[model samples]
Target: MTSPQILIATLVAAYLYVVTPGPAFLALFTLAASRGRKSGAWFICGHLIGDVVWGALAVAALVGANRLGPTLFEALGFACGLYLVYLGVRALMTRKDALPRTIGAERPLATGMAFGLTNPKSYPVALAMFSAIVAPYIGALKAADAPQMFVAAFLGFLLADATLIFTAGLPAVRKFFLTHGVAVTRVVGVIFIVFGARSIVDAAQGAMRKTA
Candidate 1:
């Protein structure tokens, strides 16, 4: 088990990663601007669940599943990067005058989950956190302790993501976004595209480094 100090340190590290506006936040921002606050909240719920699962899987990989895990995740990263870029392009091309349609609960939830699960940077960031902050303290932890570690890491993810979603949905924030919805969407689209391009470049570099 991790000491209390180590646990706190790990959560703090995770928050640093989660709070940074990355692909995940870019995706959420697009949804909140185009759809609405309710949809953004649902998306946040889905993303939180995905983060927990990803955190657990990262712990499992470190514990034993490394043989195939890294390769599989890299491939997913490439695919997801492409998809994100496409979404960005689509957002930019949204009809000039038409308002964004109200998104159903299921759509945003599923979209958020997919974005979280396939976020190209997540695995690498988690690995870095483990090496820099977590592994130093819990290197001696047994496999049985994986679940506890996973939960600790996920708390940070939940808090960071939930905060962003709720803040974006605040009445003033939402009204401003909804008022200039088209402009907001275009801005988010640009952010997504740039982020996606970066993901692709990073994934390619990682793959090359692995092969070399």
Candidate 2:
């Protein structure tokens, strides 16, 4: 179990790790690029919700720190990897004019879940960092226990992703629906491929580790 300072520090590290580019990053970025910034904001919200779910799962012991063996994790990883590849391929195949993603009410949340859940990196990072950091707090009866930590993580996730979307993705958004949209689409398409391919490789490594 981690102490308070250690717990907070762990979370900062975890948040920073999440903030770095991964499937979630690419997903949010791509969504912003395809959809408008407002849509990107919702997608970011969805990502935060997914983080909260993961954190809660960790706290509740639904996902154990060590219980998820390499085998199981690897299998799960494969599922996410394949899904990302499918998305990436689809994005690449689309025409530039088709990239303006006008989202209905459902898609913002759905896309968020799709990106967060489908990224194997999200699980390991959450399982390893999020679970471990909050494990000690889970036992405490204090108000600053699980809920506080969850809020902190959620907020951290939102800010970090929102920054990226606003900085890089928003411009793409304009190009998509306004001008030079096709070029932006192509870039996003490449990004999806990169993100998806990376997921596949990481999943394979995990799988090999399990077998070995």
Compute each candidate's TM-score over C-alphas. Answer: 0.56, 0.49
Q: State which candidate has the highest lDDT.
A: 1
> Which ranges in model 2 have alpha carbons more than 4 Å from their true place?
1-62, 99-153, 164-177, 210-212
lDDT of 2 by residue, 152-195 (tens): 56656666666666764556444533455445555545654554
Candidate 1 residue lDDT tens string, 1-212: 55676567557656655654445655566577666677888787777766776666656655552345455545545565676577678778867785544443458888777867777766654543343344334335456666666677778777777788777777787666556667766765675566556556656765897899
**What C-alpha lDDT do the candidate models reach, one value each?**
0.62, 0.53
Error of 2 at 73 (Å): 0.1
Where's the lowest-lDDT run of ten residues in candidate 2? 132-141
Off by over 4 Å in 1: 61-106, 135-140, 171-212
- Residue 51 displacement in candidate 2 (angstroms): 6.3
